[model samples]
Target: MAEAPSWFGEVERAAWDRFRAEIPWLTEADRVLVEVASTLRARLATDPAMSVNAIAQLRMCLSAMGATPADRSRVDIPQNDDDPLTCYFN
Candidate 1:
């Protein structure tokens, strides 16, 4: 797994870890998007005063990455028979 950016706070680091865990199919090429999503999640967690638009944008980012159940259902990650967790994609 890629290391979280050094500037990431605890919340961001936690969010990064969760994304990496849940989106195991993500390649190094997806790192930027993951970082963006993690940063947005951390911002949302720490800033209750965030504007509705900002929240919506974060939700969009999460959805694009298949982080939500509905979005995940739309994704077709290939299953690796040797990896039990991959079976979840099937």
Candidate 2:
């Protein structure tokens, strides 16, 4: 199995933590979103070309769960100058 991009774990964990903290009562939709995020994280590990799309979806889930960053500076997803997949964000 292919390993995830270096920043994947950190980003995923942060989102998961935020979700747990913000949503004490999860609806069925919330549960589905969580499951989708987990599935996407694993799939993105093997198919990085889909990182942008996966990240977008994850962001939507986070936003829906009210887990968006309170301060933009505090959100640190990976940004690699050399990797086109990540450099776009920078």
Candidate 3:
């Protein structure tokens, strides 16, 4: 298993949980980020010349997903007060 990016902090994690509870499609970006990272980690660990471009793509995707320099990236999944995820899923 690959280690999660060092950048993902408490705020990011909470944001993801919030996203999952609200807009379901937004979770795809998170999942894709992890999947791509895992693949890159494997290749980068073993192969040389694995093209920095791939890493750049990951960072771009991260930024598109609202990552910040502070590692406090948040997805901003707004939930209604009566949201099901905040209630039963808890």
Off by over 4 Å in 2: 1-25, 45-47, 70-90
Clash list (residue pairs), candidate 3: none
Model number with the top lDDT: 1
Whole-model Cα lDDT of every candidate shown, in order: 0.84, 0.56, 0.51
Going through the candidates in order, what is the number of backbone clashes in each? 0, 0, 0
Candidate 2 — which pairs collide?
none
* Worst 10-residue lDDT window, candidate 2: 1-10
TM-score of each: 0.75, 0.40, 0.36
- Candidate 1's residue-wise lDDT over 43-74, tens digit each? 88899898898888888888888878999998
Residue by residue across 1-90, what tens digits does model 2's lDDT show? Answer: 122224546656554454454554445555657655655655565566876777798677666555566533354433436777665654
By summed lDDT, the worst window of 10 consecutive residues in model 1 runs over: 78-87
Q: Rank the candidates by TM-score, best first.
A: 1, 2, 3
RMSD of candidate 3 to true structure, Å? 10.5
